[model samples]
Target: MKKDYYEVLGVGRSATKDEIKKAYRKLAVQFHPDKNPDNKDAEEHFKEVNEAYEALSNDDKRRRYDQFGHAGVGSSAASGSGGQYGGASDFSDIFSAVNDMFGGGRSRAGGGAPFGFEEFFGGGGGARKGRASAGIQGTDLKIRLKLTLEEIAKGVDKTLKIKKQVACKECNGSGSKSGATESCKTCNGTGEVRQAQKTMFGQFVNIAACPTCGGEGRIIKDRCTSCYGEGIKLGEVTVKVTVPAGVQDGNYLTLRGQGNTGPRGGAAGDLIVVLEEIPHDLFSRNGDDVVYTLAVSFPDLVLGTKVDVPTLDGAVKLTIPPSTQPETMLRIPGYGIGHLRGSSRGDQYVKVNVYVPKDLSHQDKELLKELKKSQGISPDAHNDPHAKSFFEKARDIFS
Candidate 1:
């Protein structure tokens, strides 16, 4: 028996269109065949998710399914046939949903397949049935790039070396030694084969790529010796990337057409660079601002002093007022990381820490004993009326 469409997608019956789409996107990515290679259960779950989405994504089909379940919509509404599972246009909708998730909306010129569909499906299946002769797009490549806090503060340019598939130079990417090819006998040069299956509902016709020619419509009579007829080989490429300021960890940048070159004179893919921020030894970042702890001696805090603090650029003088409390934060404007989009920069916050001597010498203790006799040196909250409370100081630090 067919499962309930809402149950298959794990959505409520009254779920909105966006909610349904969100659920479908999550399930599709989880059970996609490419992500779960050689797993039969995952493949079945993928098909089920696609079928459920096909029926639910459309208003009329969803209404019919809601009223009479699977019988009302039938396989025709989901697959464009009364007996089959899915068709070319049905998969196109699935590809559209996936493309929207990845922030890619560009399609090939002259209405070819969408940008990521070919990469995910290998330019085969129903999406590229009629355009089998058209060259396939290469798969996208991803690499993690480590960036230092200093580099992120000031945007830096990086050159990366990538190893990927490049077109074979021997055959000039034709995959034929003599540059000669013949029509495929299985598909009769049409690049596709159709099969009719008899089911309980009716006859369903399925059209797919030709296996003999691998959907290229033509077969190479003489295979290339270097690439073994695949027209691509493992090679290295150098790519330059510019990273903007204030880009956080897990942020990524995409470079178009910088990835692996497709086989048989096909278009190239994209390169995805994911940013990873290296931990700083003396500083920690909080949004655009950076925080550093500055330790000062007890004598320095009692009597105002000037000390140098470390910054990304260099050392800068910081002022400590007389009787400044511990855990007080001092702000240095325009000294932190630069804003991502604007010229303005965040402030650098210095957290004050009192440095206490672990072991005092005999002379140091005698001097401290004489200073302890002074009434002003005793701990008294009434001594300073302007002194801020702990709660007030904490609020100032965070606010």
Candidate 2:
């Protein structure tokens, strides 16, 4: 059954372009096949969602779906089942746009992107033409690396030397040696086969792509040794990438044309770099704020002193008032990582944790006793319900 596009994205029918994109990106990440393996239903729903997004995300298709519903919007797909959507639409485009949802992320033309010629001119081999026989685009690549908090604080550009695949220079992307290929005879090299069947409803005729040549309309005899008939060779390539400041974990930067080369001189695909922020030993990032845990001695907190504290911008002296309680957080404005596109920087939050003396000598004990007696107080007076005596909690947690 056909489902409404808005329903698939969980958005209202009047959603704007930005809202639609947000919803699609969320669902794509959630129901992506990599995230939900071993579940056939989820995988199917994922594909459906991709298809819905692909159609509605486009202006023309969205208008068509809005005015004519699924029937008018998808009639090409229904009838194109006989063959392909010759020119009006490119099935291969649709397939590549949604292939990530399927376990087989490969495009119909293997690693290459679909060609426009297949959409413009219906090849003689196939009865109906869409993108079924379109040339393929290159493959997308993913690389993961760790980044330090300081590196993320300031944007950086890095040049990485890596290995991947490229089109076979020896064969010129033909997968054959010195023009050793010829038209396939299975379906007369048309790359498609036609058949007619009589049914009760009507004499239904079905037109399908040629299976023998794999819809390429040609056959290779002596394959190229460089790519082993795949028309792509493994090689090393260098790519320069810029890491924007304030980029969070799981954020991706796309470097186009850095992927494997396309067959027959097709354009190369893209390389996606996913950033992973490493936790700093002395600092943590909260949104745009830099946080550091500063330990203050009990005497320092009680006597009131100006102590040096570390911040992203460097060390600054912070004043601690007398009788200051533990767990007091102080903020330094405009000291953290600068907003990637904004004018101001994030603030740095210093969390003060007053440390109580754990090892007390005889003289220290006597001095504490005398001080408490002078104040007419006892150790029990320090008891706090928010996790018995903050000092004890800190000591227990740290030790």
Q: What is the lDDT of candidate 2?
A: 0.70
Q: Clashing residue pairs in candidate 1, if any?
A: none
In candidate 1, what are the lDDT values of residues 260-338, reduced to their tens digit?
Answer: 8877766778999999999999889999999999999999999979999998888999999999899999998988898
Off by over 4 Å in 1: 1-134, 381-399
The TM-score that candidate 1 achieves is 0.64
Model 2 lDDT per residue over 1-399, tens place:
777879989999999988898998898778766677566676666666677777677888889889888875675433442132122123334444444333233223222444432222233224323444323457888897578878788777888887877878798776777747778787776666655644332232344566666655567779787777767788888888889889899999988989877654445778889999998888888998899888888778778889888876678878888877788888888888878887678888888897766899999899888877764344553555654677677889999
Candidate 2 matches the true fold with a TM-score of: 0.56
Q: Which numbered prediction scores highest in lDDT against the true structure? A: 1
**Span of ten consecutive residues with least summed lDDT in model 2:** 81-90
Worst 10 residues of 1 by lDDT: 81-90
